[model samples]
Every structure is written in structure tokens, then in C-alpha cells.
Target: MKKIIVSILLIFFIVGCGLKQTIKDTAQDLTNNTVALIDDAIDEITHESESWQATLQELSDNLTDEAQSTIRNEVQNLATRTIAAAGSEIRCNVDFLGARVVQALQRIKAELLNKPIPQRNPAICQVIPTAIDMNLTPNRRNKVDISGYDFDNQPLKLYLITNDNQRTDVTHAINRLSHYHLVLNLGSNGVLLNETSSRLVLEYKDSQMSSIAITQPVTPDCKEEEISFSPDIITYMPTHTRGDRDYGGHGPAITARVNIYVDNNTIKAKIYMRARETKSDWSTADGSGVFTIYTAPSKRRILTIVSDKETSTNYIDSGHAEDFFEKGSGELVKRFAFVGDTDGDEAGTRTRVKVTFNRVVVKLKEIGNCKE
Candidate 1:
């Protein structure tokens, strides 16, 4: 029994010692594992802080860049405006400074926006061609005159003078005239004309002459008369009576009044007859012809006489003068003429004549007169 007890105690002691060693080993392993886990957590926190700091730096840099870009762009726009205002009068070192400042601002702004700055080109803002003003007048007959002045207020060119019959091409006229003026700035600041740029005037001498002297004289006629004597010797005698017989035969005089119109594309005039006349007395007037005088409407001024004949005549007369600007209507005065019996003659032997005037100026608010 003693032996058995001793053996049991030994076994107990050995087992306890083994268990303490096992427990100590397990405690050391657990402590090492905990330290390792704590080290990993600290490293993770440090790395995360570094990443946040880097991100913040990047965001600040971007913000600064954006602000700088905005400022630069604003400066560049201001400079551009200033340079534009300087116009052609800008001179000296101040202009250079202004240009440089503008360039620098634009460059900075472009850099921030990752774009290339465009270089300034002299041709971009060059004043090419120039400006011109033209005035026109009438000549011996009411004529269309073209004249021009340059930007320096100097006379530039006389492009063309033409009559637009509303049938002929106006493009040809414009092309012919364009040779005289330089096309510049899309023609906005060039080629100006006055309201009376084109005009027609009429002048006449002895307009009120009632009759014209005939170059050839009429033949005189004598009638034979039978004479009877009351005395015993009665003789039949031929009495010769010599006198100029009335061979007055006047044909209807035809006249035409013309009106000239100048517009963007269409140039036209209205024509009307003054009166209709019928020939009478075939013995005096060989043929009975209806004479018509086509007069222009009052709205259109008489530009020129298309024809003037004993049978038909057109007289371009500046019988009256009026201004468009003065009237505030921007229209011109047109004249016309008509013929009728002035003195009422029972035999329709006399004719009367008069003129009717009108206004024919185009409004300036129209567009697209010429197109290709």
C-alpha cells in the first residue's frame, strides 16, 4: 500500500510540473501574439494618416492652381478690352506694356487650363481698305454721277455713272463701280452716299413758245370770180383774189416723262401719258393720227427725256428741286407732264400742257438688294 501511495504522489508532482511549464509556454506565446497584433494596428494607423496628409496637399495645390487661373483669365480679358479701346491712336511704350501684360495674363491662364496661348497677329486687327463718302450730281441732262471720298476725307474715286432702265443688269453696274472703291471691313464703314447722291435736272429755253415758225411757206390760192356789169355790155370776167389760205394742220405732239429709281436690286420708273389727241381736218393735217405723250408718275422724278419729237418727245427737265432729308421722309421728288386743251376751242384747234409731280424715294430700312 505504501509503495502504491508514494508512486501516486510522484506521479502527481511530475504531472503538476508539466502542467505549469505548459501553462508558462502558452502564456508567453499569447503575449507575443498580442504584441504583434498591436504593432500591426499601429502601423496601419500611421499609413492611413500619411495617405490623408498627401490627399490634403494635393487638394490644396489644385485649389491654388484654380484660383490663379481665374485671376489670370480676368486680367487677360481686361487687357484685351483696353487694347481694343486704344484703337489706332495707341502709340509709345505704354502700348508695349499693355500688350505684354495681356500676353502674360493669357499665357498664365492658358497654362492653368492646359491650353496653348494664341499669339497676337497684326493682321487680326489691321485697318484695311478704309472709309469713303460719295456725292453725285446731274450734268447737261439729269445724269447719275458717282464720286467717293476716303477715310482721310480725301476724294477716292468716281466709280461709275449709269442709267438703270430696270431691264439692264444692276450687278454689272455695281461691278463696274466697285473697281473704283476698295472693299474693306465687309463694306460696313466704307462707301457712303448722300440722300441726293443721284439726281435729275431739267432745263428748257422758250418752253412757253406757243408756235414754232415753219421753215417752208404755205402756197397761196386765188379763186376765180364771175363779174357781171349792169350796163348794156355785160361781160363775165374771172376775178383773181390772191390770199394765203389757212393750211394749218397740226399733228398731235407726243411727249414722255421718265422717272428713275435706284434701289438695292430693282431700279424702275412709272410712265403715263399726258393726254390723248386726235387729228382733225384732213386737208390741213394730212393724216388723222392719235398722238400720245407718256408722262412719268409724280412719285418718280423725270430722270431723262426718252424722246422729244413733233410726233413724240420726252423732256428731262429739272423744273423743280426738293430734298429727301429735308422732308424727313427720306424720299425724292419726281415730276411728270401732261398735255390738254388750255383754251377751249370749239374746233379743237388749241392744246393745253401742264405737269404733275410726285415723290419716289426708297426707304433706307430695306435689305438684300444684291445677292449671288
Candidate 2:
């Protein structure tokens, strides 16, 4: 544009000189001609300027659109990258890049309008892509287990990434909602999972966008079906089972598993404990009892176990006790068990006791019609 303006000025200067030399006799006419020439030059320059500006403005508009599209896609990808690994520093870098792009966009517009470019944003723009990695296979019904996630009433979205790096937004229908899981009906859409890892984007009503990154895939020894309990009962039925040998004989050689069920009212517990002998076949005991949980500190009879075979603390006829410390509602109920070798039954055959509880954690529930 500057070059064009300079060229126009040179042509006007040459034309004025020629007109002055040609009409030496007609001074008044020469003056009129010179003035006309100047006017013509000025008009031509004005028209050219407008045209040039329009072109620049058009270019700037196109470039701005391109830059915006590029930046948005790049930021999305950057956020996805952070999911497998993310932190504050990485976000800062991404924000810096975005700011630079924004600055570049402003410069493009400034050039188009022949104006000064504005300063970039001082703060880094964060693009939090809290994405969840959903693994699935083709022709399968998969429900993302959000049991490990500690969020409720959160809105969620799903995204499907194409092979060409295009992200397609997908919607999900809730099949079932439970305390430990969210069963989503993928329908025939799961066929897309045949290629890529299912990516579920979750966000809350008053929160930023969240990808399903909060869950760490863990393979538990025993996986119970997802169940729904009361809101106060944040947890449902949890089971725990463990069995191993005590090399130093610090404890007994034992194998046990316990299943605890909790709801809005009372807690029912089923426990199985056994005393095993490394050498000979020994008697084993099985017990199922009820735990009494109330606001008071009463030490009443809370347990009754029917044993298949009974054995003592030291292979004698000693039994276990039922005692616990229950806090207020919606809290953990704990029991301290000190099962030691009260009877020195190891004299005959080296043996130990094994215990397994469904879970160490017991979630308190609402007391609605609870069997007080």
C-alpha cells in the first residue's frame, strides 16, 4: 500500500511539470489545468487507498478465522495430552501458546486496518481437558465405572476422536445410576470404540470442563456388582478377602472373607474365619452375626455365630467377641480385634488364624425406618 501511494505521488509530479512547460502562454489556462491534474491525482489516490484497504481487511478476516480454528483445535489436543499426564506447569505452557496466538491475531487485524496492534493478554489462558479414558471393544456394551470418582450430580459429555485428529462430540443415555457406578447405554454408537479408546468428557453444572481422568483403572481381586444405597449411605455392600501364611508365626496361618451390607437402617455382617494347621486337618468355624449400631454406648449381645467346627484360642474352645466403636451417622464404624494365641495349640500342629472382612470401610446410611 505504501509503495502504491509513492508511485501515485511521482506520477502527479511528472504530469504537473509537463503541463507547466506546455502551456507557457496560457498562464490562466495552465493554472486551471494544473489544478485539475492535482484533483484527478487526489481522487485516484483516494479510490486506490479504499480498494487497498478493503483487500487488506479481507485478508485479515480470513487469517483471523484460520488462526482461531487452529488455536482452538491445538488447545483441545494439548488438553487431551495432559490427561495421561497433567500438572500446573504444562497448563502454563499451553496458556502461553494460546496468548501468543491471540496476540498474533490482533496484529493481523491491526495490519488490515493500518492501526497499531494491541498488547497480548497478561494472564495465561488455561484449557483444562480433564478427559476420561474409556477402554472398550467392538460389538460390546460397556459402562464406565465411575465408582472411584467422588462426584455427584455432575453433567457429563462424551467425545469420539477420529483417525484424522477430528473430535466428534457424542451423547450418552444413562441406563442406570447407582452409588458405585453410572451405567451408560452406548447403544450402537459403541461401534466407534472399535478403533479408539472410549473418551468420556465429564463436567459439573457450575464447574469447568472435565474429562474422565479422575478414575484410575484398577483390577480388584473381587468385583461386586454396582448397587444403589441411600445418599447418606455413600457406600453399598463392600467385600474383602485375604489369605496368606505368617512365616515368623507372628500371627496364625489363616484364610478368611467378610461381606458387610449397609443401608438406610441397620447393618448386616457375614464373617467366615478358619484356623488352619500346616500339617494335619483341624476343625474350622463359620459364623454369621448382626452388628448393633446406635447413638448410645451399650455393650449388649450383638453377635451370634453358628460354627461348622469350633476351636479355642490355643486350639482350645475359646471364642471371639463382638465389639465396635460406631461414630455418628454417615461415618466409619470400626472394630478392634485382638486375636492372639491365647491357647498354645501350636504344640500339636503349627497353625494360624486367617480373617477376611468384606471391607475395612463401612459407610453410614440415613436412619429412615432403620431397625433401631
Candidate 3:
């Protein structure tokens, strides 16, 4: 009897492991399919029609709450462990597993339903130098080399930008400066007196790259390098006076602002809504439901919370922007946007908030600190 019971327990353990694996595989398939669907639907969602509303509703219903809960729990556990173990720098765990679900239903409801949508500008600037390093001795002539791919050499200008917002044009003063090199006259009388404090601004046509610092070949006291992300804070306000549909029919002009930032290794997004004409209709009809963030491609949901009432912060498990500095690509952060909806501040008032801009990029910042 003892032998038989032990054999049965072993069999059960094997079967249980197999079942767990099957669930993860199924969830991953769901995640991949959802990402493809959202990528294809982004352009189509802009079209004004009722069919979009119905389609989005069906998509939302199909993504049952149980599945999302399961994925979220699994992801949260992994994120916690990964964040705890990550040294050197804290990195948001990349969602190798398909878990985040994009809330397309909220976006569709906000943009459609008889609301005037805002015009989004996707035009971004490209052509920037990848490397800006200078070799120089204090108070002497220095050689600065700037190189990048697909650089338009015609009509290039180099300027010196100081800490107190001063710009000095030194394009003509530099001798033997070519498409990739610049001979800067350093020191008190020359362009740059302090190598560590000042920066070099490179311009090609209308494209510009700012905050190009100098790096020394040798340093006696080198502190730890500081890492930071560019465009530390992003604030967006609607350019048009268009309003969204509410329970009381057409409402006054709606003004919306979205703020996206990364603080303490956590990525956060928040929205502030108010009447353009009058500061009313600040909250949504759903009480604690106002904004949602989805991951790109898969449209996996990252965060959803009550906007204007509270702040929504999420771990960088999924939908976090990375690969900020890429060659050939323009200066754009390709990530997800916050889609919001709310009722007027007054009872019986409902309004929709729509945002079309959803691109984010990441740059790994490494600024050296030297002891004077």
C-alpha cells in the first residue's frame, strides 16, 4: 500500500507541472495575438464611425478579467524579483511573457461617441550626431570630433552654449574643421575657457543636438557616472478647442494635459482635464476609472486608474520605452499614450478625453563626475 501511494503522488506532481506550462503557453499566445491586433488598429481607430465602438467593445469583452488577473499576478511577482536582483542600475523587467493588455476599449470610447478629436502631429526631427567627444588641455587649442550615420554635411554650424543660456557662434573661428572634426581655440580668450562646464551645440540644416560635453582622456579622481533620461518631464495640452460628448449631449470645449515621466526607476503617467471655457467636468462618471495605458504592438495593458483624482504609477514591467539613441531614426520617444475619459465635474455630466500622440524613446545617460 505504501509503495502504491508513493507512485501515485509522483505521477500527480508531473501532471501538475505540465498543466502549469500549458497555461503559460496559452497566455503567451493570447499576448502575441493582442499586440498584433492593436498595432493594426491604431490607424483605424482614428476613423470616425460607430463600427469602431462596436469592434472595440467586442475586443474588450473577449479579454476576460480572469485572464488579465492571472497575468498581472504572474508579472508582478517577476517584476518584484527582477527589480530586487538588478544591480548597477535599476531596470524595469522586460515583459518576455505576454501579460500586459492594452485598454483599446477606453481609447475608442473616448475618441468616438460624438466627440471632436484633436489633430496629432507625428512629424519628428532626425539626423543627430551619435558621438561628441573632445580631447583638450585646459587653456589650449582643442580638437573636437563629431560623427554619426547619414549626416547631411551641407550647411553645418557649431555653436558654444554656456550655463547661463548664452550662445556664441564659433563656426568661422574654428580652423581646419571638417565634416567630422573641429579645431576649437580653447582658453580664456578663445571659445571655451572651461572644458567641463560648457557644451558644444552641433547644427545640420534645421536639426540640432544640444548638451555635447567634453571628456578627458585621463583623470586623477573620477567619481561614479550619473545616469539620466532626456526630456525628464513631458507635458501635453490640447491645441484645439474641440469638446467631447457627455451624458448631457455636446459639452463645452475640453482641455486635457498628459504628463509622462520616470521617477525612482518607476514609469508614471497622469492626466489633468478641465473645461477650456470653464474649469468644470474634472472627474469621470465611472468614479475611479479615467485613464489607461497599453503597451505598443501587443497593446497589453500596463496601467489604468482614476485620473484627476489620483496618480497612476506602474513598474516598468511592460510598455516602458527603451532604445532611445538609435542611428538614422529621428528624435522621437516611441511608447504608449494615456487615453482618458471623464464625466463633467457636476453630477449627470460625462465627457471623453482623447490623445493620439503615443511615441517614446529611451537614451542611456552616462555623465562623468570629476573631482576638481
Candidate 4:
């Protein structure tokens, strides 16, 4: 099970870092040939003009010039534009990978679920919300508590599989561990039935990820380390119009999922931020901000988000073009902080932009060696 989890991480990292060109080409050719074969078989059934028998006959015997020309034209069109993108589509295709991994995980998940293994992107990032550890002396209730952490605190529909894979959702649920009758159902006579090894598996319909993380390595100096976070998790504050002196912060107070990457030499983070624009659109997409790495530490410059169409871009050029990075502390401490100035008050005060890092997904203590 440990090896399987490790394999899943390696798979994503390799796919994310980009695969070798030769292997990519081979995979592309294989995928194309596979698709072509499936299409050829299904053509007779779908293309009502030809019967199955007639399709076979056409293959064996000579065909009319129009039919022959159709085949020739189809084969000629499979060039760079058609084949190059296929390999890239396959690399980031986690759904394809998860379908295969789910079969194996079903076998491992039946038993030994005392510890969770999906902390850092398992085949799927599952949050099986559990309650505090318990120890029963006598006359204790038999049940389990779970949370719908991934689905905005909704009731998580799942199966409670027994040691032998027997599952049921008929048990009673309350504010505490949902109670189930143990003695009435099992271990009759003088013996007591202990059903502690049961585990929860998500329903097939609810398997899609709520979001995705975009991670990148911090620097060449640091040993292989990266940060990740979903782009949609940022605060979406509507920007103040250009030349507007001062307006109330009448915007949606959304939180951003900021992922931190820390190593011996540096600490870097990736966050979802909205690009500054008069009217928000593709040009104001959060991803428009591009960071440029430099030789000196902390000298790395981050350009403001560029428009999706590349029509406009806000670059953090001047010393007062306005960007501030702060590390949090004390009782109400936050892991990281970033403030980027958009077109603030004409009075020279920086206005709060459309997005900010209100949530840090990873902590320095989790990585170790980073101090408070």
C-alpha cells in the first residue's frame, strides 16, 4: 500500500515535469492507432450507407473513386496539428489514472485504515473526516463519525465496509459518532463482536476532485521542492475603477488557498491572484502574474497578472510599484502573506486588489527545518 501511494506521487511529478520527447511521440502514435482502429470497426454500424457485409466487401474488393478518395483524404490529414496535442492531453489525465488505481485501492482499503495515506495527493485527495480517538471501557456505543470536508459541509454519502467488505448506511447518525447496534446483529451468545476495522469509501458518483493544485519548484539552489494550490481559491474583490479617488471595499470577501514550499535556502509560495484590469475578464485572469527568477535570493520579481489575450499586463516594476511579503506570527498567526498594489487611491495609498492569500495549505513545520 505504501509503495502504491508512492508510485502515484511519482507518476504525477513525472507527468507534471514533462516526459521525454521520444516516449511522448510513441504514446501519441499508439493512442492515434488505437483510436483509428476503433473508428474503423464502428463506421459500418454508424454510417448507415454501408452494411457490415458491404464494409467487409469494400475492404476486400476495389471501391469506387469517391470512397477511395475519402480514405486517402482522411489519412493525409493526420499531421503535427492532429497528433502533437494528444500526448499532452494524456499526461495530465488523472481520471484515466484514477480508474486504474481505484481497482487496486479497493483491495487495500478493506483493512488497516487506522492511518490515512492521502495527505499529499493520493490517487485522489480524499478527506475522510474522523472524530477524536476513543477508548471504550464497557457499555460503550458502536459507531463512526465522518465529515463532508470536500463538499462544503454537506452529508457525505459513503459506505461503511466491514472487515469482510460488508457495507451499510442504515446506521443511526447524530452530532456524535453515528451509532449502530453491535450485540443485536453479531457475536451472539457469550462473545462480543468487535467491528473496529471498518472503513469508508466515497461513492463513485462523487469521485471527481473539487479542485486542482498547480505546483512549481522554487529554485535551482534548493533541493527538489515545490509549492501548490488551486487557482479558484483566491478572494475575488472587485477592483476600484481607474482614477477613482477612494471607494468602500464593497467586494466579495473570498479566501485564497495558498500553498507553501520551504527548503534550507528559501521559502516560496504559489497563490491564485486576479490581474488588475478596468473590467475583469481573461486579461484579468489570476494566472496572468508571471514570476521571473533571479541570481540573488528574494530578488525574484513577479510581474502582475497579464490579460489572457495578452492585450494588457501590469508588471511590478518600480520599488513603489507596490508589493509586500510578510510572515505571520503570535496567536492569530497566518503562515504567509502577500500584498500587491493595484490602481489604489490617487492619494498614493495602495488599494486592496481583487485577490489575497487568506489560506495557506501547507505549513513550514510540515516540511521541517524552517523556523518560526
Candidate 5:
């Protein structure tokens, strides 16, 4: 029975993998809003069965007629085979199959969007390709680097989960070359310090989850800093834009607002970004993540911020920026920018986007002990 199940799964897995790549390639041609719409339609299908066909039609509108027909046929055929296989030894219903198929499709969609996925069973983990000969070591600048085969080729998220299940995002720390590698800058604000136990987690395509225990402690030079900013909310608008195409220019202007909270050595930011490609079309990028803020004068502030996976939309990726006190306003400000290669590099359709930060209202400021 297990063999049968595995065999059936293998068949579906192959199909799913192929379909995943095809859909992802197709998605590259779609605008961000269009892709979000398709994603919402898929989300709708998972919950309601009666209107799936109609929703599927909406999805098909963006795809080629041939591709749409092929997807429809594939779904029907896969459903039929699942039912046939179930009849021999088990029971299956359309509702169950519908839910499962939608879940699988959603997973694929998440991967394409470079978003994190919900936790599922370990069996599903087998299909995801993993790193080989991987070695992770602490490097200078309060960062860690993981190197090995197949390490940095695709979009992935990394985290440091403490024993109590607190997760810290460290995904923006990567070196993107012909052969990808990781350069994790775990800031010196002692955010990663004092964890009783922690492990580095990696989430890749299809939510392939892999983890390595942090057997060796990372005891960076410690320090405490007193920093407080007011208005609690800072609004960021695009200060400059350079790309083959302009984002949020077609309809609404793109904007990001961050609600910030400061603790001893860490900064908690709830970030919300409105990425509107057009007036009638828009999608949100929102999530909360922590930042390790190291004070100046040996307090190195490396602003690599990633959001919480569970609550953030996949579109709201990590922000790589700098945090500093504005010389004139004395406001604690964060400046960051991101790039969008709406089309591949060979096509030369790259957009280097920049956004502006508002003046910070500093209420309190202090520096704590710095240990070497």
C-alpha cells in the first residue's frame, strides 16, 4: 500500500514540478497586480468549490488559451486518476481532492512569488532540492555565511529560531553572483545573543524547510543603546525610480509606512507597503520583522530587515537599508531601496527603485556598554 501511494505521488510530483516551473515562467510576464489577482483566485478556489470554474476562468484570462486548456485538462486528469487510485483501496471525494489540489497549487504559487509557506508534513519535504556540502560559519561584521552546492541560486528565506520558537529573519544577507552564496550580517545590537538555543532555518521553493542547529554560540561584542523615535509611524515614498518600467506609476504611487517599536537591542518594525501598478489595480506588501541596531563608533548598524513569514505577504520582501541619525533633524531614520527585474537580465528590463524616509521624532537617546 505504501508503495502504491509513493508511486502515485511520484507521478503527481513530477507533474506538479513541471507545472510549477511553467507557471512561474509565465508569471514573470505578468504585472505584480495581475499575479496577486491570480493568487487571490487560487485562494478562493481552496475554500469554495461551486465557483472554482468561474474563478479558473478569471485565472485563464492572463494565460494563453493553449496553456489554459492544458491546465484545465491536467487538473481534470489528475482528479480522475486520484479517484481511480482511491477506489481500489481507499475512499476519496471531490471536496477532499479539490482542497488538496488547491493546497498544492498554492504552494507552487507561493514559491513563484518568493513567499513563505505554512508548515506541512515532512513527507512533502522530500521533493525539494537541498544544499549539499553546505558549511555555515560566523564571519566578520556580525554576519554568518553558508556556502556549498546549490546554496544561493533561487529565492529563499532564512531564519534564526530560538528554543522558545522566536524567529529572526536573516534572508537579505546573500551574495548574488554566478554561483550564489550567503553573507549573513547578524547586527551587533546583541539581537542574536543570549538565546538559550537556536537553529538556522532555510525555506526554499515549495516551502522546502531545512534547518541546522547553531551548535556553536555566536557571542558578538555586546552593547546596549538607548534609542527612541516618535510619530511611531514613518511614511516612505519613492524618492527616485530607475527601471525599464515604472511601478505604481500606472495607477497609484507606491508607498511604505512602518510602525516601529524599540527594545533593548532590537527594533521591531511592522511594515506596510502599497505597491500599486495602476489606479484600479494594487497589492499590499506587509509584515513585521526585527532589526539588530548597533550604535555608531564601533556600533555597526547593518540594516538588513526581513519580515515575519506567517503574517507578511510574499511580495513584501526584506529591506536592505541604513539606519542613522539625520545630522540636522536629529531624527533616527532608516533608508532602504529595492530593485525589481520585472524581466530577466538578458532582456535588460531592470528597475533600481529608491524611496524616501521622513524625519524621525526622537524622544530619547542613550548608549549602553560596549564590550570587546
Candidate 6:
């Protein structure tokens, strides 16, 4: 009975130890499984978040490109509309005033072409009358008698009448009257007439037509090298007998004038002869003329002469006048020139006589301080 009890106790101890080992193994297995499952779940969530962030970035880029394109198109449309409106305004303004200006210019051109060349004679000096009044009321016969005096204060006559009570008629008369070539200007509600030649000038003011007289003088304001603002001067030269006898005999004397006011200051003065009442021609000696320009203070003279044939000469006598100024200084002095033609080749066929009588204005420099 003692051996049986000891064997039973040993078996009980062995069974208890086996049971504890099994429980420990089972608990370790469960913990390992739980840790693996949590790691897998975290990986899946990270991948999904990355995909969502990439999609959102792509959508933002597309929206930015579309918005920029729309803004560019809208700006272009606004600019096009603004330019179109500006062009329309300019076109409309031009269309409204273009016709009237054109008509006025045409009328002036026609009147200038129709004007008569005055006959040059001592007794038959041309006369221009001024100070005529016009009545604006339609169909009313209001006539203004225009009269004036010649340069010698001789009585002159001119008729002033309105035709058909039309504005065009008045404009036509004004155009015709201004073509007379006389200087008729207004000063303090009165007319100032510069009548020193045969050319008559008529002026129109307040719808009234007036006239100014021009005459030739025996002796004019003469200066050897005087600066003049008139741009013209007249002189007389005696004719000579030379060359072949078969050629027509020249006149006893040649009366001529120099017109310096030609197309601004770019052109030189034109030299013309008045042999008879209506005869005039270029100098036979061609371009054998001298122009001496002088500046003030220094009074230095710059001499320019045309020594070639008229046709071959590059200098045109119809442009801006020359200027005289101090070097490096904007100072203007009274400027003047001596213009004349000299005779070359004594044979009458190509007689070279001195030709002088043209003049022009001189340009001056502005005043300024000297640079140190």
C-alpha cells in the first residue's frame, strides 16, 4: 500500500507541470497574431492617404490653367472693344468736317486762277478799294460802295454786291478779292493798305469786301546791304548794245525787282526783269549772282555766289532764308545781304551784266548764359 501512494503522487506532479507549459504557449501565440494584424491595417491606411493627396494636387493644377485662360480671353476682349470705340470717334469727326474744308479750298483755288494780271504802266497803276459792308438779312438789297486811294493818294473805285443771298457767293467773292496780290490787312477796325506796286489786294471781313491799292515808285527805300522784312526789292539797270546785229535790239533800260519771299526760306530770291508793261524773263547770264550775308557784332560777311548755269545749279531760289548767328552762342544780330548779278563774256549774245535786287530775312540765335 506504501508503494501505490508514492507512484500516484509523482503522476499528479507531472500532469500539473504539463498543463502550465501549454497555457504559456497559447498566450504567446495570441499576442503575436494581434501585433501582425495592427501593422497590416496601418500600411493600408497610409497607401490610401497618399493616393488621395495625389488626386487633389492634379485637380488643383487643372483648375489653375483653366482660370488663367479665361482671364486672358476676357482681357483681350476688353482691349479690342476700347480700340474699336476710339477708331469710331476719329472717323466720325473727320467725316463731319472734311466736306466743308474741301469746298473752301476748292473755291480759293478757282478764284486764284481766274484773277487778272494787272497791266503795268505809270498812269494805269492798279487800284484796290476796301471798307464795304454786307447785310446778313436775306433778299434785302443792301449795297456797299467801296473806294480807296492809290499809293499816290489818288481816288480809286470798286463795286461791292452780294449775289443771290447765298453764303457760297460771299465765299466766292472773298476768294476772288484776296487773289489780287496786294497787302490788305485789318488794324483796329480799319483797313491798312500797302499799295506800292501795280498789284491790287482786296480783303473781305465781316462778310464785307474791301480793296487796297499798289503802285510803283520812282525811288524806293534804298539800302546798300539793308536787312529787310518785305522780302522783295526793285531796281533799274540800263541796257547795253553788243553782240550780233541780226539779233533783236534790246530795250533802252531794264526795270527789275527781286522777290525773296519764295516758299519760306529754303528757296533763294528770283531775279526778274520788267522790260515792258508785261514782259519779264530770267537773267540771260544765268547764275552769275552773289549773295553776301552779314551777321551783327562781328559783322562777318558770308559770300555765296552761283557761278554755274541756271539749269545745272543745285541752289534753288525759293526756300528758307539763310541765318546769321554767333558761333557757340544763341545771339541774333540784324542780318542783311547784297545780291547782284555780274556780266560775263562781253559779246552781246552772252553779255554778263551785274544783276542785283533780291532780299530775304535773317535768322537769329537765342540768348543764353556762357558755359564755364
**Highest lDDT against the true fold, candidate:** 5
63-164, model 4: which lDDT tens digit per residue? 222213222223232212123212332232333332322322222222112224332221222222232112343243233223221122234344444557
Tell me model 3's lDDT, rounded to 2 decimals.
Answer: 0.36
Off by over 4 Å in 3: 1-136, 139-141, 148-153, 173-190, 215-372
Better of 3 and 6 by lDDT: 3
* Candidate 4 TM-score to native: 0.14
Please give the range of 10 consecutive residues that has the lowest summed lDDT in model 6.
307-316
> Candidate 3: worst 10 consecutive residues by lDDT?
314-323
lDDT of 2 by residue, 279-314 (tens): 333333223334432221122221222211121222
The candidate with the higher TM-score, 1 or 5, is 5
- State candidate 3's TM-score: 0.20
- How do the residues 44-149 of candidate 1 rate in per-residue lDDT, one tens digit apiece? 3344532322322332243232213233234444444444433343321343433433344344334333456654322111111111223212121122222121
Q: Model 1 misses residue 76 by how many Å? A: 29
Q: Candidate 3 on 1-372: residue-level lDDT in tens?
A: 976774455445446754233334344566555444444443344443323433344444444534233333433443343233232222222221111112222232223222343322111122122223445344333444332211223555667776576777876644433222334455355555354445666665646743465443454453323222332334333222333333132223333444554433334556554433223442222222223332222212223221221222221112111112121222223232322223323222323333333344432222244333
Off by over 4 Å in 2: 1-141, 148-152, 163-165, 187-191, 194-198, 205-372
Per-residue lDDT of model 6, residues 154-205, tens digit only: 2222222223221112222221121112222222222222222222233322
CA RMSD of each candidate after superposition: 35.3, 24.2, 42.9, 34.9, 37.7, 41.6
lDDT assessment of candidate 1: 0.28
Query: Is candidate 4 or 5 superior in lDDT?
Result: 5
- Candidates sorted on lDDT, descending: 5, 3, 2, 4, 1, 6
Ten contiguous residues minimizing lDDT sum, candidate 5 = 124-133
Q: Which ten residues in a row have the lowest lDDT in candidate 1?
A: 229-238
Candidate 6 lDDT at 206 equals: 33
- What's the candidate order when arranged by decreasing TM-score? 5, 3, 2, 6, 1, 4
Ranking 2 against 3 by TM-score, winner:
3
Each candidate structure's TM-score, on Cα atoms with residue i matched to residue i, is 0.15, 0.18, 0.20, 0.14, 0.21, 0.15
